[model samples]
Target chain A: MESHSGIAAVVKKTLNRRYRAERRFRRIGLAAVAVGLLFLAVLFTAIVSKGYTAFQQTHVLLDVYVDPDVVHVGNLDSADYQGLIKASLRELFPDVKGHRDKRNLYKLVSSGAGSILRQKVLEDTSLIGRRIQIWVPADDDVDMVIKGHVDRSLPESQRRLNNKSLAWVDALKEQGRLEKRWNLTFFTAGDSREPELAGIWGATVGSFYTLLITLSLSFPLGTAAAVYLEEFAPRNRWTDLLEVNINNLAAVPSIVFGLLGLAVFLNFFGLPRSSPLVGGLVLTLMTLPTIIIAGRAALQSVPPSIRDAALAVGASKMQAVFHHVLPLALPGMLTGTIIGMARALGETAPLLMVGMVAFIVDIPRGFTDAATALPVQIFLWADSPERAFVEKTSAAIMVLLGFLILMNGAAVFLRNRYERRW
Target chain B: MTTVGEIRAANPRMTCRQVNVYYGDKHAIKNVSIDIGRNEVLAMIGPSGCGKSTFLRCLNRMNDTIEGCRVTGTITLDGQDIYDPDLDVVLLRAQVGMVFQKPNPFPKSIYDNIAYGPKIHGLARTRSELDQIVETSLQKAGLWDEVKDRLKHPGTGLSGGQQQRLCIARAIAVSPEVILMDEPCSALDPIATARIEDLIHELREQYTIVIVTHSMQQAARVSQRTAFFHMGDLIEVGPTDRIFTRPRHSLTEDYITGRFG
Candidate 1:
């Protein structure tokens, strides 16, 4: 009786210990999940806090009266407007009497604002005699001060903008001369040398054209290759070799594709450098592997019985694929395509290797024209010495993130809508 | 049991001449020969791995899709060689449709599922014409009255029996000459199975039907001729009544009497 009681106690202890261990494991799993959620929350908060200030920008409202005599020179040629604007600005603040103050005021406005004014004058010759209220971009230091990047207590010698300039900015703000608009131009304007004036509009257009080219080329080619390889091609060494190469291509880094594009598109084919067309061809090579992999997976997920049923109904092999398999695989294929496009949009290394890093100041007129992408613009701004470029870089990053989120959201929507069950 | 020579006298639509099938090194079907006549329901019944389904798939060359599966010997339909290289597989499948063991209705509307084959084959030119094809096919599958109101609904949304009927309708939409059924009722409940068995009887009027069934009772109830396979060989095939009551081969006799699988 004593031995039997001892044995029962051991069994009870073992069972209790086992149950406790299981509970401990479950608690650890729950803790891990909670930690993951906390990490995501922290990341989101950081991105929002650092990136929110990028969307708003400060502009100096200048009421510069266009001097008719200077602007409308002998014959009033639109091309001479730039020189007239510079002459008028020089007359407004004579460099002799207020040389230092005038230079400080000039520094507050972006150096490229004169060029912008000139372009506007060229477009409309009648503005020479008019008193127009133009909102010129403020210099990077002034932009930083408005964004609270510069502390007021900093010494004049150490600060980018001195006390005198800061005083002038304060006066302008009090007089409602410095205003913050919605920054609509940031979304509509093109890339620029002046960080205060740079926008993602040009890069967005480039990305659009590139994605169009990728979709047009990759969709049909990828699907056809997948269908042939999955359904029609005989299982042999040759097909095996093809499958291996496809998998390897998917693993190859995007930069290699850039180099390949440089060699083939730029060197061999002599395509225009820095064109969206070349960028798109490079992106197509980068995206094809993903599309093919996804297409094959989608096609393979379809049950063999469906094919059997189609064949049984007297449908040919081609009929079975087109009539049954292709339609079913479309949703998954679309999700993959969207994912591939998102990856292409965020790709900077490949574009950098190709001539996307080139300084493109105008909006791309066509696929064959020079273009810039959002990430490339961010990289360019982040490298600039202007303090205003810091905000612009963050803003460009936000735009890039928004596009990525949109693409991924589309993928999720398509997946949820058309995902099928046997 | 009557020999293949005697069975040939009945004007068979399909004749398998000593057909053999191999999957890589394994002999799946050995010297199996059978004759199927028009409007006749022929049931091939045996235990698992007995080459019953293999022989049924051979009828439609569905085996062609499987890797490493090779068929030797001739299978002819109405005296036309089925394995000829020049034969269009699509046309052949259109003539000989199949319903799988598990109902595989395309993920499409009930109307569209039936319309798919007819549309692909250019069997119907206009919407009204396609609608007529869908209606006739569903009617033939014995599901038209029950589902006619919800024809626009997904075929996959149907119950098991209804989905199976939808697949049958999809098969019949192209107006195939022969319908091959591979364990079509195995995944269903007894009630669903009974409905499918009834539908099979109804389909025989328009199609030459061949079915692979695991249930002995189903074979007795629905088939006019029955083929019993054992160990990748056609052990015996004869009239349903004779094969069930007095199978000549010992293997067939043992299988029927439950002596062994």
Candidate 2:
């Protein structure tokens, strides 16, 4: 009786400590989860807050007389649209007299404003003699002033917009002629020195073409390699070495692939520089190991009994794989391929080495065209010595994140749709 | 040591002589010999890992799928050597079907599971012919009435007994002359086991079946002849009635009388 009571007393004492330890462990796990969620929330808030403004832009509505002589060049493409824009600005603010003042007055309109006027004239020849009112993009400096990014209390020398330009903007705003409109140019145009004219469309198209090439080349090759290794290859030292090398390739730095592309695709084969074709070839090399690894894992996940059943039913080895096992494993392979493509979509360092870092101004029309991917565009915008490019960089990041989410969502959907139980 | 009792069938469908099996360096089966008579059920009973299942797998060469497993010596099916180099293993398997220990229904509809074998062998030319083959195979396995209304449902959705019967029906659809069953009732309840035993009695009219079982009573109930193995050696072979009633090897008597396994 004495020994039993002593044992009971010891158990009673340690039970409370065990319970308390479990509670403490649970609390630590909860804290870890909470910290992860907090960081994610902070990242989203930072990107959305800085990038939402890029979706809207400031515009100035002005009435301009398209004088026939200024726009009536022998070739419509060579028409002097700049003169028409300058004459219209002079009409709006007639008090500006000196050459410097006149130049400053002309600075309120975007330098690309000539293209808009020239486009309108080319579309409608009847507008040559008519005074038409149009909403044109404001210059980046004027846009900054209107958006309140430039401090109005700052001296003339300290601010991007001087008092003279500020007065014109205030006058326009008071008359309800300066308004914030949807930034359609930000989605429709290409890279430009002027922030207001720069858009993500060109880079988006480049990314599309690059990924198209990557998928076409990598998916079939990766799946075939995976099937051969998993299903058909004999277990020997050679195959073991091959497997280890494939795993090692997946961990290799992506820039190494870019250098290989530079040396092989560009220099040896004389493929065009800065083309989506070359960038895609480099990305394919970078993503092949990832797809092959994922594909093999998927093939391995299939139950061995399925293979036995097929073979017992008199199926040849190839027929068994192609008929039953492949169908069951296909959904997994597709998920892996999409994940690899997403990684390739966001890859930057490899593209930079292959000359896809050029400031391309046209949307890529083909695989061989000079192009810049979305991540490269973000890198270039982030490095610019301008205040507006900061918002543009954030907006580009948002687009990239949206694509990644969409691809991952697709992977989940496919997995759930076709994954078999037994 | 030689096996006791008769190892020859009056009319044999498959004959094995001096067969040896190895897994890398481990000798799993040694000089085992048996004969499977046509239109009969032959039951092999033994303790776990006594090479009974290994010998049954050798009938259809199912052991070929296992890594490092090797089989030597001659095994003939209807007087033709099955291990010849030029023999088409696919055709051999088509002629000799199999049912696994567990009910492994392909993750497909019941109809497709039945139709898969016939379709692969091109046994049916028209769609209606294919449908007929599926219906007849299921009916022969005695699973038609229970699943006729839901032939399109997944085979995995069936009960354990129903799934096992569907596997039998899948094997039957191939129209093989011989069927190798590896512990067909080991994973089933008693009622399901009774159903499979009844199906085996009916199937013995048209197919030669060699079953690997653990229950001696089940062997006495369903099989016409019995083979007892111990430590990778065939200890006794005789009629099921005689093997259960008459005195033979001490190991066989000890195992049947519940003295030891």
Candidate 3:
């Protein structure tokens, strides 16, 4: 009786120890999840806080004379409208007669101020020989003062904007001539040296064109390849090798796809460099293996009985696959395609190799036009020395992330809306 | 005992001659000769893995779908060799439909499930004609009254018995000459099993029915003729009543008297 009691006591002790270990494992899992969520929250907060200001820009409104003699109506695109802009600033503060002070005052407005007048003159020749009130962009240094980024208590030599230019910003504000509007130009223009004029329209358009080509080429080809391999391909050594290689290709580094594109598409095919067409062809190759794998999995998940029913009804193999299996597999296939697109959207290295890293001011008019995608645009801006570009880089990242979230949301919505349970 | 090679029906719809089957060098069925008569219920009964279901599938060549599965010898439908290389398997399957051990309905509306076969066969041209076929198929399977109000509901939502009947209705919609049931009631409750048994009795009047079942009682209840198989060999076959009451082979007698199976 004493030995039996001792064995029972030991069993009880071991059970309690196992229970305690189980509790510790649960707590560890909870901690791991908490750490993951905390990282995501910190990243989202940092990016939003650093980039949200890019949506607003400061502008100085001035009354200027669009004198035809200064603009030269015949050659409006090349005219030095910079002189007229400096003259307008001088007129605003006529008391600053010294050349060095006048130069410091001229620094308050953006260097693109001349290009803005040049665009306006070309847009409407009627503006020539007439005086009109125009909103010229405030310079990056002046913009920081207006947005409260510059500390006024600092010594003049310690800051980027001199005391004279900083005082001019306050004077303009007091005169109700300097104001920050919703930066519409940021969405309307393309890449520019001036941060206020830089917009994502070119990159966004390029992304759409590239995605169109990639999706169009990959989806049909991937589905066909998947259907053949999963359904019709004979069980042979050659087909098995192809299947193994296709799966391995999905795990290959995306940059290798870029190198392949450079070697074959640019050198052999002679496709235009930096065009959405070339970028799209490269992305298609990168995304095909993923789409094909997903397509085959989706096809396999459809019950064998469904195929039997179709066959029992006298439907041909192709007929049953296209009619029943393909529809049932659609939701999974679409989810995979969207994920592939999201990965393609953030790909910058391959696009860089194909010359999408070049500074392009004009928006791409077609698929063949030279273009830079969003991530490449971010890559370029992030490497620049300008302080305002820091904000632009983060904002472009936010835009790219927004598109990814939208694509993921669409995937979930499709799965829920069309999901069929058996 | 008609000399082992001459187990034939008077009005045979499908005839098998020295049929053997293999799954990658593992012989699954030996030389078996049998005949499935037209417009009658023929039941093949055996213990598990006795090649009963394998023999039934040979009629429609459904085993062709399995990888590494090969069939030799001749199986004929009507008076033609179905194993001929030029014979269309699609058409053969349409002529001989199948019902599985478990009810398998397409994930579609009740109306669509019945209409699937008809649409593929082009048996109906106008919308009303298609609706008529769906209604008649459902009515013929005795499911129309229960599901008439919810034709648009998915077929998978039906009860076990109803889904099996739906599969039966779907098969008949293609107007097949023979219907093969591979233990159609094995997955159902006793009550559901009885309903499917009654459905088999009703369907045997128009279609040649071949069923493989483990339960001797089910075979005795529904089949006009029964063939008993043991260890991939056909042990005895006769009229259903005679096979149960007076088995000619000791193996069949052992199986029937519960001595050994």
Candidate 4:
């Protein structure tokens, strides 16, 4: 009894220390989670704050008389729409008179404003002689000034906008002619040398085609490989070697797939360079290992009893797997396929080696058309020498993140929908 | 050495001669032979790892599913060699079905669980025929009244006893000549065990059964003839009453009298 009491005292003495250690471990776990959340919060705030303004563009409202003499040139394509825009700006600020000042005055309007007027005249020939009020996009510098990105209080040498140009913008604001509208061009048009005229549509379309091919090619190939390896392949040295290679392939740098694509697809097979077809082929090779690994894991997770039940009922081995095992494993396979596709969507290095890094200005019309993926577009914009491209880069990053979230959400949705209790 | 008790039946349905089972390099089941009679329940009882379940699996070639498990012997159903390579295993399994120790229902509705075997084997010509087979199979298993209202519900949602009955019903839906049950009531409670034991009694009128059980009392209760296995060898086979009371083998007597299993 005395020895038992002594043991009890020892236990009682250590109890509080054990509880304290438990609490300390819990506190450390909470701190780790808190730190992760803080980093995520910082990233999201930085992207959103810089990119939100890119969704709205600055526009200057102008009343321009489409002089028939200037617009009705014999060749309508040769019409001087820029002259009409210049004449309209001169009409708005009649006091600005000299050549250099007039040039600064014309700089307040985007060069694409001429193309907009030309499209208007082409759509309605009668508009050639009438004075119509229209909102036209302002120059990127004027846009930066209006969005508070450029400091107007700085000296002329230190700012993108001169004091005179800032004065014209202030005059336009006073007349309520300056407005920020939804930047539809960012969604509807293609990339351009001029940042104001650029949009992400080209990159978005390229990404869609690339992923479509990647999904179609990799999913079937990966799932078939996984099923054969897991279910039918004899466990021998060759199969073990194959399994090891598959795992090793998954860890290989993605750029090696790009190099392979360059040598085999571009040089030997002679597929079109800088096309979604080639990019999709390259990405398929990159994602196949990931998909196969995931498919195998999913197939393995299915309880062996289901197979036995099916087999005992006289179902063939193939029939049993296709009818019961595949259906159960499908949700998992789809999740893996989507994850691999998401990675392929964000992939850029391989595409670059395949010539997808070319300056593709047209929205990809077909799989073989020259194209640039969203990440590559971001990379290109980020590398540009224009200050306006900074916001565009962040905006592209936001779009990429949105696509990633959408793909992951789809994975969760499919998993929940098809998941069954065994 | 020969088995100590009668090894031949007056009307044998399946006959085994000198069967041996090997797992990798281990001799799991030594040369043992027995006859399974028509429409009779044969119970195999033994201590753990004595090759009773292994011997039972070999009856329907379920041992083929396991890696490195090899069986060699001439086993015949109705005087035809079942081990003939030309004999389709799928067709053989349809002729002889199995129910496992643990209840394993497909992740499907109750109606579909019974219909799956008949449907896959093309036993039904129309939807109505399939539905009829499902109802009759469930009725025969004595689960129709409890689950008739929830035919569309998942079979896995049933209780443990109900699920085991469902698996038995699934095996019966194939219209097999023989049903091999591997400890069909071990996972169940006493009441469910009694219910299954009664079902086995009634089923013996139509289908030949071979059951492997751990409980000697279960063997005595449900079986006509009992075979006792010990250490990879079959020590005795005789009428259950004679084997429990007037045993020929000392090992069988020792196992039955609660001395040492």
Which candidate number maximizes DockQ?
4
Candidate 4 residue pairs in clash (backbone atoms < 3 Å): none
| DockQ score of each predicted structure, in the order shown | 0.65, 0.78, 0.77, 0.82
Q: What is the C-alpha RMSD of each candidate to the true structure, in Å?
A: 3.5, 1.8, 2.8, 1.7
Our tally of clashes for model 1 stands at 8
Model 3 DockQ reads: 0.77
DockQ score of the complex predicted as candidate 1: 0.65
Error of 1 at B85 (Å): 3.1
lDDT of 1 by residue, B1-261 (tens): 223313452878899888999999999998877789989999898889999998888888888888999999988888998999988777788888888899988777899889888877899889999989999999988899999999999888999999998999999899988999999999999999999999899888889999999998999999999888888877778889998898877888888988886
Determine the iRMS, in angstroms, of model 4: 0.7
Task: Looking at model 1, give its docking quality level.
Answer: medium
TM-score of each: 0.90, 0.97, 0.94, 0.97
Candidate 2 lDDT by residue in tens digits, B1-261? 699989999999999999999999988888988898999899999899999999988888888888899999889999999998888899999989999989989899999999998998999999999999999999999999999999999999999989999999999999999988888988999999999999999999999999999899899999999999988899999999999999499999999998987
Error of 1 at A136 (Å): 3.0
Candidate 3 residues lying further than 4 Å off, grouped into runs, are: A1-15, A66-81, A115-132, A148-158, B1-6, B257-261
Quick one: how many clashes does candidate 4 have?
A: 0
Flag the better candidate by lDDT, 2 or 3: 2
- Model 1 lDDT, residue A12, Cα: 97
Better of 1 and 4 by lDDT: 4
